[model samples]
Target: MLSREIINLQVGQAGNQVGESFWQDVLAEHGLDQAGIYHGTDPVQLQRVGVYFAEVNHAGSQSKYVPRSLQIDLEAGVCDRVRSGPMGGLFSPETYLHGESGAGNNWAKGFYTEGAELIDPILEVVRKQAEACDVLQGFQVIHSIGGGTGSGLGCLLLTKMREEFPDRMLATFSILPSPKVSETVVEPYNAMLSVHQLVETSDLTICIDNEALYDISIRALKVNSPNFKDLNGLISKVMCGVSTSLRFPGQLNGDLRKLGMNLIPFPRLHFLMPSYAPISDPKTQSYQGTSVPELVQALFDRRNLLVACDPRNGRYLTAATIFRGNVASREAEVAVRELQTRNSNQFVEWIPDNVSVTLVSVPPVGQKQAAVALSNSTSIQELFLRTHETFAAMYKRRAFLHWYTGEGMDVMEFSEAESNSQDLIAEYQQYQEARAGDEDEYDEEEAPSEGFSQ
Candidate 1:
């Protein structure tokens, strides 16, 4: 049972901060408080701690469940805050990976110097956690692709993890930078470069855009100025939904191995846009008990999506919908039937039937039910559009170019990143356009997108 254990590695300020929120969500779900005290274990919740966490044995009985996660930051402030925060005691001091100075939003600084220096120490902790796993399947890197520490060092670790554990799988949960507000003028640089590494090294990378989260925060939570705390909570819910099948036993297609097969048929096109419903938050209270068909339909709504994607325009290459908490197998099948038979659920010409629905009846920690959709759709092209445009605008003007050059990184790296990102945008665009002006029949020239059954 522990053979497929996942080793999570949370990198950078964005990663650690998000990691904090994620842990908070998991703790709440498991009825564990900030003090690590058990609130209640009514039916006994599904704890992934044994797989992704290690217990620090106390006197004779009580033990602290510390995640295999290694929280890293180029600077001290974020890591320091987590080390002293309310939930700080729940974590081990050794898990906080740090360096002398911040990356100043420069990707090269983290990639070349900082990440290179911390590799040995970080791997040591990872080794200890892996040894506990008995059979370490792979890693889940939680980080933003638009920041220095997350983007540069996150990519560095992705490559390093691949080299260190060649047989294991590497998956990333990446946060896309908001289009409007950004701290780094060179966010486009960081995002594109990391995107290249993610495509190359990782088996699957689930992307959640900040634009969608910010909008959800304002509309769903009704927060005037939502901070990372609020946004991270929303992200954590989606993560929980995606991971429920992994944490708890289900019929099929629940574990990390099957999730990869369901989400990523094509190795390169591994970007999955996650959408979950019904949206739950602090301000929001009741779940009106939506019908199965409505639940299925709502799964396609961009409003419920963790990432901002245009579903109306783009084609779905493949999709996997996970229904948890009291959802029956018959319910899921009927819902998918209604969508396909009664309503329009668009799919690409290559795979007309790409949506694989799975029903897992795991008890929810808070919400009564959740429908999480992991879709490999061409709408992801829209995300690349935002990064590409902003990157082009900033790159053409040579904005913040000196910081990278000063770090001893070659200037041509930027061009390479642009070229790779541009290729991605074009590839998705081709996938989207191929469906148009052509019959549903597969063209020999068109790339064959892999598919699987429910």
Candidate 2:
């Protein structure tokens, strides 16, 4: 299978330098102290992956501009290398940032601009590597979905890659800017739209907020420098956390095709939280609904909220609903119940067996994240009882459904149909021979390969 990681750096902007520092910090966090050493080393095989740097032309005031030096660090030692075939030519689209008109003029500007021609060479290299593999695999593309270059261009590139390599799995790690530093109205909306587009095409999309990461750095590490180095280090650590968790040897490889066999396409739901705050009590607790808002804020404070979603799926959530058990305070329980009832009346509709609901309860950090799935159940007790066996039990139900109804099932059914069709044709030939009184039976020879395999 093809396994690759493609990181798009915002070369011309301050974020580009920040990204470098992020990478360094991540390496340091993982205990890899050598400078530039992390780029060449494979996380799985622990070898050097060839790193290549390319020059991309960023947009200026005029239509044509001088190219800036942006680098793509590829770990070639990894199993799946980017191919050099038809798929490689897919990233040949220009990246442009769109801005709001009139009042938002100051808030809008091009982050990075590049003609389609500039991406051609990079894609060509990817195509060549992909074509040589027997089974095209998984890819992790990292870049910020903020400002111009990373958001606009990165989304376009992801869309093209998805179109070209439909069979292979792809995931994107997007960095979001802090609301305070953002241009407020326009930039946030632009970034959100860009990310939405990328998520629709990708298998899984992971988001890291710059504000959250920065807070962690300042509070936890006491890093005072606001320069690119420190900022980049924080971003890199977040990326590394995700990359390490998903691709670590013991962890299930985060290939969507493989994941599809055991889990539903992660539902697409937008998680809206008020904002970040300082944590007064570092101690963790199982708070009820009355305190859920504070708990969520605290979770955000720790920068530990991990949200995964598939935008292509039709699962839209308009409001938040919290559920608490006996561990929660009485006030918290009452508050949660009231909120759920209110939300149920306003936003939720009770569909029959068609819809599945998942309730994941994250325990105090030292414990595991508890998850329960409910279908057509009125009380939480029934849902919890059904899902109480183990973490795998909760996923198993979803996995079975995904395998039977999702694309995974479709692919298998299609293959079976082709096999049956071939069998029918062969039988028809045999029947015709019998009718014509022919004694010999037909025998088929192995087909020759033209470098491509079915």
Candidate 3:
């Protein structure tokens, strides 16, 4: 197979922070230093580096690898920080784009006013990046859904990308808001509007929430007072895990579209829950030893989920489990099969053999073995429901109507967004109630209660 390329777009403060950690990990894995210079002697490290990097050669200097990524924000503060950070030189200067005045946490300001003004310039930069790829597979956007820049401007860029490169795959590492760690009162409004746009724009949306991140850090990593950096580190691990097959030689190598095809059973139902295995504090690594089966089980545990939802509430439509390290393919396959057989009732019978596994020979930088799973489970509706309730509560009183309407946005867009979000929630509920071999005859009253057949 030809080496495929992926362009990453990081938006807003949260997105750029996660992107920073992501690039740091990616560089370490590919043996590239802080300055993007190759320092390791392993030739295999550079084999599939083109997936996220562009190899540049100067007239008389050795080769340097630059990330094919863009850092965008509605304010200049975040972008400026990244430019002066430790790995600042790793990126091309032109990739950073920002505006003078911040969006002030207003979705309309970012989407209709300030964000719209910068769309054409952002697209031009993206176009140049795409042109440089040998075989561009798709783009991955990293953003949050609870703020102005990430929620509003991020979706704007996604809309334009879909229009400009209709055929390429579009995936996102979307950060959803949680009341536990919210920075603004209108996060529900911002989040719902972003989801409405994501339903139409993105091919795959990997849902994440701060509540879950806090739980994992506190419980697993033993972080007493977890901060954004702690949360971003966990997200960066999953981000790298999801792209492992594309970044390295793997037994079951699948590109962005192929991976999406396997996991996404329906078009609008592309939101997924991600879980990572062998999650432990580095301080306790010496006492921990995990097997393939244990790791797979960990991947399904609700505590390990990056999104705050219980898989037990809804059946699994499909899943892709990517294992990294020296684990044998035969053992990994057996483990997944046994897991499916043991917990057959947890999965949907409509899609037989719904679980797929991939084995990458190289493990993460510090771990002996690791695993990541992306589950298209109906339980994720719980997340949307939470956002809907908050949005409805706030909309009922028209608490922050003036800020949005002042930016030339009509009140109908809010109604449409709310209605669209409700519809999305209903769609998930519809599929959750569906049973195998009974598409048309799915009578809710007669649904099985004991357990679904294998």
The top-ranked prediction according to TM-score is 3
After the best TM-score superposition of candidate 1, give how far the Cα of residue 210 lies from its true spot, in angstroms: 1.4
Winner on TM-score between 1 and 2 is 1
Q: What's the ranking of the predictions by TM-score, best on top?
A: 3, 1, 2
What is the clash count for each candidate, in the order shown?
0, 28, 0
Regions of model 1 farther than 4 Å from truth: 1-3, 35-39, 42-49, 280-284, 342-345, 434-453
The C-alpha stretches of model 3 lying farther than 4 A from their native spots are 439-454
- Candidate 3 local lDDT, 86-162, one digit each (tens): 98999999999999898888889889999999989899999999998889999999999999999999988999999
Considering lDDT, which of the candidate structures 1 and 2 is the better prediction for this target? Answer: 1
Candidate 1 lDDT by residue in tens digits, 191-235: 888887887898888999888888888987788898988888888
Q: Root-mean-square deviation of each candidate, in angstroms? A: 3.3, 21.1, 2.9
Q: Model 3, 56: alpha-carbon shift in Å?
A: 0.8
lDDT of 1 at 301: 79
Top lDDT: which candidate number? 3
Q: Model 2: per-residue lDDT, tens digit, 1-454?
A: 2334333333224334444444443334322333222222434323212111122333443111111112331111110111132222212222211222211111112212241323455455456545544444555555655454455455555667777887666655556655544543334433543544653676654455556555555554466544445555445434443333232333123333433222222232111221122222223223323244443224222243222111111111221222212223343334334433433322122211122111222121122221111111111111112112221233334333232232122334323423333343343233222311133332212211111000
At residue 355, candidate 3 shows an lDDT of 85
